[model samples]
Target chain A: MAGMRLQIIGCHSATPRLLARPSAQVLEIGNSPVLIDCGEGTQMELRRLRLKFTRIEHIFISHLHGDHFFGLPGLISTFRLLGRERPLHIYGPKGIKEAITLLLKLGESWINYPLHFHELEQGTSDTLLEAKGFTVKTFPLKHRVPTQGFLFRELPGLRKLKPEVAESHGISRAYYLKIKQGADAIAADGRTIPNAVLTEPPAATGSYAYCSDTAFDPELPGHIRGVHTLYHEATFLHTEAALAAKTGHSTALEAGKIARAAEVNRLILGHFSSRYNSLDSFRKEAQQEFLNTELAADGKVFDWAEL
Target chain B: MAGMRLQIIGCHSATPRLLARPSAQVLEIGNSPVLIDCGEGTQMELRRLRLKFTRIEHIFISHLHGDHFFGLPGLISTFRLLGRERPLHIYGPKGIKEAITLLLKLGESWINYPLHFHELEQGTSDTLLEAKGFTVKTFPLKHRVPTQGFLFRELPGLRKLKPEVAESHGISRAYYLKIKQGADAIAADGRTIPNAVLTEPPAATGSYAYCSDTAFDPELPGHIRGVHTLYHEATFLHTEAALAAKTGHSTALEAGKIARAAEVNRLILGHFSSRYNSLDSFRKEAQQEFLNTELAADGKVFDWAEL
Candidate 1:
């Protein structure tokens, strides 16, 4: 199976500081490059990381907070300045179009390229985007405002052909695809070749789930059950669980509990509040519930095959 | 005379690059700290420079271009997050309030601090702001959109009193102001004391003019005549003079001509286009016309006393 990679651009809560940044990530699944949750300085971070801005064809925003998508207008304007001709797509919550349009109108900056905005509705959980190699689904998240989590799952891979067996059977390259699709090759003399003898089984599919800026809920595990990797927000430590609940955010222990219930293979914790001086306690706290838990750091990359 | 310090936070034009940043500056005039032309990522630059964010009470925006004022909303939001209670005032072109209001409403982030917006009118030149020691005024600039330049002038200082001379003349502290206002002190017994015997003359008032994102116009020199120092945008070189005119920007030679025509003491060329890899040419070109011309670099400081 083709491996997927996730690059954590930023994963802090609230305003950007010297050490911490707001939420932003880049997920690379096969040939598709997708950007998630662009905060105030996401473009600068992306440039710092040496990521090609024009290659990011699709962007997904979790909510309407400035930390989630305030950098959209600047990024769009930059793409125009760089003379990008490809169409860019943005998937965000409602009111995003109006907000971006108002800023552009005020600056009188007309975009030279096509910009497509896909607004997600409230109280809906459905497939949001589908590409050649992967699909993105949105699930409702409980926050102070309307929020949603994204699930990226790769499609099943093509079956492998037994080259030596196919060569002995004198099968042409055009007919090999038909044989890999579980079809028996019928020869010109009306003789049939068994499909099982010509092809091998397909590889297992991989999936990743992302949940941020949301409170701990029991129903979250049901939607992302058996995910290969889950990135859940751990905004606060267990000591501040009360404050977390009041602010509609989750603690490290709470995120671990959700990951444990979901039976995911690996759990990544992110969206940490800047109040915590050290991140060692977050990993220590979450590891008590989920053994394979790790803390998310900016510019850190996670490969699906490593899990 | 009290000195003014200008901090060049960012001096590049258009989109920010790896080492170059967009337009933003911090000018320290006596006791007041003023922020000028806040572009994107300006708040981060302010933090990097270790400037006191809460101490900045006034923000002057030259125009509605994204590179000039897009950082306002983020800075305001960060101030709220940092628990600032002081009133913050913004002076900019029309539609600034509407643009900021829409973004804030979309994010549902209500500010706790008082934010006052002063919109500039087209084809008008007037005093826009007055504080304890400094005053800011606006002048028309020729850009693609409705734009303006700012003039910051320090108020005249109090006359220095000769303590022994005043004491010998039996001049009480209550009558010190009368003696300092170019007045002859009248003693209690009706003795006349010359004004020059009691106090020294006040120092000359210093002024700074900022003209950015504008084309070369002859009328500009008339408005900023005899200014102590001028920061004029030199977006292109003389080789690209035609491109500069097409884009409503000025070349280095043109900015120097304006400084020479206006009879300004010093010229600081800024808002440079990112195409020129080396900035030495900009200074070389401008210095041909105006001998005391300097390039505006990030983190470069210009002291009014030096000029």
Candidate 2:
């Protein structure tokens, strides 16, 4: 429960194939569901998975591609119709606000809740959010348009409290929080009690990186190095490497190479081109360079440290 | 084959709930499938029904409401991805081209096929298209936004040819088309055969009209009078007639009056508010004034004269 879980709602590239959705996923980190890239049919898919739409508070978009951004307007409008009161924050490339608000103006369906848009225009990585127990950072991606790869890392949690130890030291209940924060406690006799002797160590945190619609960039590995799981776009196979580069996409082998370079614990490849009949080849090919590689599909879920 | 078939892809109003889709339909007339009002899940519905998306050449949009037009950009982008070569024609309210093209430009997913937009700005009724065996016309509607109601009427076909009559008359094979066009046939001896003697009467054609998100306007029935099937929005019941009028939506009772005044063969009530638990009340209320009324639901199909 303390780890991260990435649920792939859709992972296809270019367009939405029969049942293969475009780019959209629910990354649950720190017990919060963050939406990434809302393509067409995302709302239906969210409903299909029975995930509460209201739980998605923050949305991270990778780029301005239609497959990634086409569903934003509909989802935003649906939120208003559902009488959403909580503020919705959208982080993506510039011009998202204008494009989405224009349709709202035309329909006269302005939202009742606060709608915040954080437009990213820089070509460098920046920390975007610091939430309860995790932080979200964006790194630059090489694409035809402005793109950002999101990295979610959990923060170190507080140390567990030892009630017996605290009682033996005659420590008051008010000082328990300070002891869990690694601070020494002052006992009833005004003597200092070492926190190391009282409480256990905090649980290790996990990290997951999501990079899509990007070409093979050697520098990308540096931003997501040593992540527990890295989701990289493998839009084409090794046979179409040239076309993949020309279109600012990566082949399965190239994505594997990036995973190997980053030394990530596991690799999950997605955003596959619909031209391929079966996705088995993607995993087989990526595993050549990164042994712990898995193919992403609709409704596929990956918990932390699971290949 | 000679009659029209109206397949309701989605008929609920406002947001797309559980399995209820928003406003979208496929009206097949004269053997060609014409798309009407593409909502959020229209493409998925089309795929679910195994309807060939390419067969949809002409798309009619009643208004700029999100439920009616939000899916256009995704559908257009998909057409390009699917390698659609033929041109796509879209008829809707003004500013549709600008709204849709803006997204296309942002995504850089310009369609390879020629996409022509017919934006209607005026509030006057006018014929928009005259195709193979049917003609499409738009009529003004009372709504918060600039909305248009579409009427599709079948054109007269060639008279049926009687092979036995033509053989006995000794008419030339090359003159069969002429005889079918109601021309008299001439025998080898210069004797003329009356057209009625050589050909049978042509089969009758059925017409369908689509109207949604409109208030109760007495003048609307005159525009689509005597249609075989009139699909009107019945967003609320008579109990909420005041609320319906305020929202620029028609109640079931009001829609029934319009159908009765228009003297349509059948009435299909759609666009019901999601607040209602059962749609039976809408059909029952509409049937009070127009006994031939029926309720429209997701995936509901109405054949000509089925009511």
Candidate 3:
């Protein structure tokens, strides 16, 4: 199986604090890098993590909140300064293109690289990016402003080889690729060997769902059903449920309920409110509803291979 | 001396690095905080330093470069999030207001505090602010864009009272205020006492000049002549003089020459190019021409009292 890793760059809600940062993350699936969000100070976090700048060709922004996409202009300018010539693709809500372009125009600067923007609608879910055996889809999210959640689904891995069975069937090495592709192999002797008999089944497809800055909505589980890993925002504690609802944010308990209802294997809670000094409470609150809960700390990496 | 302290936040040129940051500094003159040229990630540095955010009422922006002004909108939003109601005044170039306003509008967010912008002219030198025994003036700097440098000059301090001299002259205590105001005092016996006899000289007026992203121009010295301390941009070493000139930046040797010609008491070199690792070389090169040269290291504070 190709490795899938999620690197949490910043997950604090509202504003950035001394220890806590705004929302941002990097999802690496099938060796392809995708940036989930670009908050203010996100570039610094990217530099601190020592991630390959050129590898992140695609950036997905959830909304136009200053904390969500304020770093785009700066990051784009930095790329030009670093002499990047590759095209950078941005998938975000409408009005993002105008916002970014306005800032560039005001600065009297233009990026050297080609920037392609894919504006998503708030009413419907749609596939945003498909490349490298991975497909990314955007689903509507309930927030004060127009927001969307991302779902990353990995394609099926190559079939495992049953070497002993293949040799017993006298299948030539040339037919190995066809067997991995789930095709029946034809031997030189004009014999038909079923693909299942020649190779073992492929590994289960790995999928991840990211829902941030959204309120507690029961409809979310249907769109992200049975995701292997889910990252949901827990912007408040259970005691502040009213505040969370008012702000269109999810409490830790609500995030747990959503994750459990979706039947995700592992749930990662992030986008914590700065009011809480300790994150242990968030994990504990989430674990009460969902047994397998993980706290998304800054610079934390969740590697699917290790899991 | 009013205990002027210069706080270096980020001084690296162009993009921010893992350890180094872009250009930003806080000048505490006469116990009043003034922010100069806030670059991206500067607010985090301010929080890391534990500065009193409310004390920074006035901010000066050198130019519209993304690094210098990208942090303004976030900082403003953060102030609002933290429940700041005080007026925040910003002095910058003509397009600063439009640039900042557009970003705020895009986010659909508004600040709670009164934000006042004092846009400076490109070809004019004028006093922007005056209060608390200090006056701030902007002078044009030679850059690729319409950039300006700031000069902070302290007004004359309160006259110092010589107790022994006053007692020797038999000056009444009620006459002290008049004598301290540089007025002659009349004794109860109708004898005139000169103010010089009753009081000693006050401390020298402290001044600081900030020049960044500027080319080495001879005319700069005329505007910043004899300033107590000058912080000039040393973006390159003498070997890369041509590159520095092409980029509208000054080399360490050029900064030293400017400081020497301006007859400034002390020179603090900053806005360094990230290509060079050892800053000691910058100091050494500047000291060759201006002996009182200092390097503007991150988190380094230059206190006039210590000097």
Candidate 4:
């Protein structure tokens, strides 16, 4: 697997304000891109970021809230207008299909590409979606509605074989395959070759977990423990902790605590309330507990290599 | 009544483009400000325009399209958060109630302000809504769904009473009201006074008709005939006439033809397609038929006095 990067398209919550589009982000892994939570102006944000829409093969919608998925119909329609032929797969909660279908029925039948909808039911966690060089899973999150968080883990790479040593030992094709699979081999001439002598250790695999628009849940630590990157919602501050709980949201301190308990390498906090005039307060509050905390500003790009 | 002004808040069609918001417009008629076609980013657009949200007493939605009314829920939610106590009246097609109710149910428990819905059905054209100092009437429009246009007419002012002339004719205060009502007065002394001796003619009344998103309909001309300001959608150009018809949209030439047939003093064309890179062709196409055509740009304010 290649390096992965996350781009924050929009981080504002509730209503849009100055310089923010809405709640949307893009995860770029290798050549494929995965869009998460497209809000009203997601397409515009994608345009601003200069991202190729054709590269996005999958979209993950957290819930049916307007801020979460209002831009889906427009993005779909634009894709059709742009003459896209590739199949676009969307994984979301059950009500999303009905919401999208209702929008399509309202005289906007211009989509020419194939759109696949995978409706996720409530309380279903660790649902495997795709497995190639990497694996993707979903876990239920505590929210006002049936929302789910996504986990992405890159598959471990094959061990590298020492070509010079293998050639000197005259290793056969079957013996080379066994060596690459971390097995010791005994030759026909009674010469033994250890697996450590023929193969080097595999590269480390990295993982990213996205827990958006959810209340602070300590249980998430066990599910997303030791992830490379964690993107959590910090919609409010500690001063508004009561309001955050009442609205099924999380404060910056709560998000920091969750990141600390999960032991994630880096924490990118976003989904800020429109009431906040600036993001400085959120950064200050979250960094108090977690020094690796970073505010998820719109258009900010976070590279996994940096973590 | 004061002068009427048309404020273009969000003008991009299909999807928001080039940092412009979606399709929303503010029609400021004297002291009453009415919102037309509240799109997803309308609240932000309203804030950007520096208009007080409380001044918007009425909202007229053209259809059930997301680009037309998806911003209602967010705007309504913000209104509640702002502690607005004034009644907000919304006029739209039959499905508007269901859409708004579903959004409210998904978010807050209840709204603090009084919300009123006037669901419009077919064959209800030319129905008067308010007739205090001005008259607001609805007219049918041709579209993919059930949609209606609105016409606002400022009532004729009372005739100016010349005090010197009234005293010379011995016109009392009781007779002045009858004279202003365009009737000849008969005093208690059995003396008849001509209405011409008491008052002069009233000022010319003005009318503004908003013909939202619709295809070319000749019937609309008769309904909104001779209006001072007319807003009609120009979704496409003449080159895309076939596509416009297939999508139930109109070209700039078609919109201009309607304005020409209606004999409106000024025509404002908007709701541009995202495919077009420039609006020069729209202006040229509409100006070929209607000389007084104006392209409705975002944040542009068209004062009625300019006409």
Task: Report lDDT per candidate.
Answer: 0.88, 0.89, 0.88, 0.80
- Superposed model 1: Cα runs more than 4 Å off: A186-193
**B46, model 2: CA deviation in Å?**
1.2
C-alpha RMSD by candidate, in order: 1.8, 2.1, 1.8, 3.5
If both were scored by lDDT, which would come out higher, candidate 2 or candidate 3? 2
Q: For residues B1-307, could you state the per-residue lDDT of candidate 4 as single tens digits?
A: 3367778888877666655567788877646788888877678778777888667878988887767777787687768767889999898888677767765564433788899999888547865567456778888888777778889877777887776777776667776776787877765466887788778987666688887678888888999889998889899998899988887789999999999999999888888887788898998999988999988888999886653
Candidate 3 error regions (>4 Å)? B167-170
The iRMS of model 2 comes to 1.3
Please provide, for model 3 over A1-307, each residue's C-alpha lDDT reduced to its tens digit, 9 standing for 90 to 100: 4478889999888778767888889998868888998888888889888988667889999988888888888898899889899899999988888878877786777888899999988857888877878999999899988899999998887899898888877888987887898999876577898887888888767889999889999999999999999999999999999999999999999999999999999999999988887889999999999989999988999977633
Give stretches of model 4 more than 4 Å off. Answer: A108-110, A161-195, B19-21, B122-124, B161-196
Q: Arrange candidates by lDDT, descending.
A: 2, 1, 3, 4
Each candidate's DockQ: 0.70, 0.69, 0.68, 0.34
Off by over 4 Å in 2: A1-3, A305-307, B1-3, B166-174, B185-193, B305-307
Model 2's chain B TM-score? 0.95
- Could you give the CAPRI-style class of model 2? medium
Worst 10 residues of 1 chain B by lDDT: B180-189
Candidate 1 local lDDT, B1-307, one digit each (tens) = 5468889999999887757888999999857789999988888889988988679998989888888877788898999999999999998899999988887887788889999999999767898887787888899999988898999998877787887998877777888887777788886667998888888878767889999989999999988899899999999999999999999999999999999999999999999898999999999999989999999999888887753
Clashing pairs in 2: none
For all predicted structures, in order, the TM-scores are: 0.97, 0.95, 0.96, 0.88
Give the winner by DockQ.
1
Could you give the CAPRI-style class of model 4?
acceptable
| TM-score ranking of the models | 1, 3, 2, 4
For every model in order, what is the number of clashing pairs?
Answer: 0, 0, 0, 0
